[model samples]
Target: MFGYSEEQIAAFGLSFGVGAFILYMLFIIGQLAWESKAGKFGTFVMFLGLAFGMVGYLAKYIIRWYLER
Candidate 1:
């Protein structure tokens, strides 16, 4: 579709979906910190913990890229 192969189209859709999900997760984390009255330090800690999944996903992609290359 739109001149892209099926794999490329699927990848684009999945990438957008993943990006939206990550944004929603971050918003929820921010709301949690605000409701809990977590100050700057606490908020930082919350994000650090919450972002580990994203960091791991990124690391996996990086490792895959290097290995594939």
Candidate 2:
């Protein structure tokens, strides 16, 4: 396509886009915990809130795989 193969595009999307987002979310969770002095329960809640998008993205992948089959 745009001077890159499908594999190259997919690799960049997963490795850079999704991977960077996950890393940023982890940083956010850690920062929330540290700045707020959140205890274990609070930290868990923060993670669940912040990381839900990532979880949904993964779930979509799984759902698509199953539906395609």
State candidate 1's TM-score.
0.69
The alpha-carbon lDDT assigned to residue 47 of candidate 2 equals 90
lDDT of 1: 0.87
Write model 1 residue lDDT over 30-65, tens digit each, in one string.
Answer: 999999999999999999999778887668768989
Candidate 2 Cα deviation (angstroms), residue 54:
1.1
Regions of candidate 1 where Cα sits further than 4 Å from its true position = 1-6, 59-69
Can you write out model 2's per-residue Cα lDDT over 11-59, one digit (the tens) per residue? 7998579978888879978997989999999999999887877887778
Which 10-residue window of candidate 1 scores lowest in summed lDDT? 52-61
RMSD of each candidate relative to the true structure: 2.5, 3.3
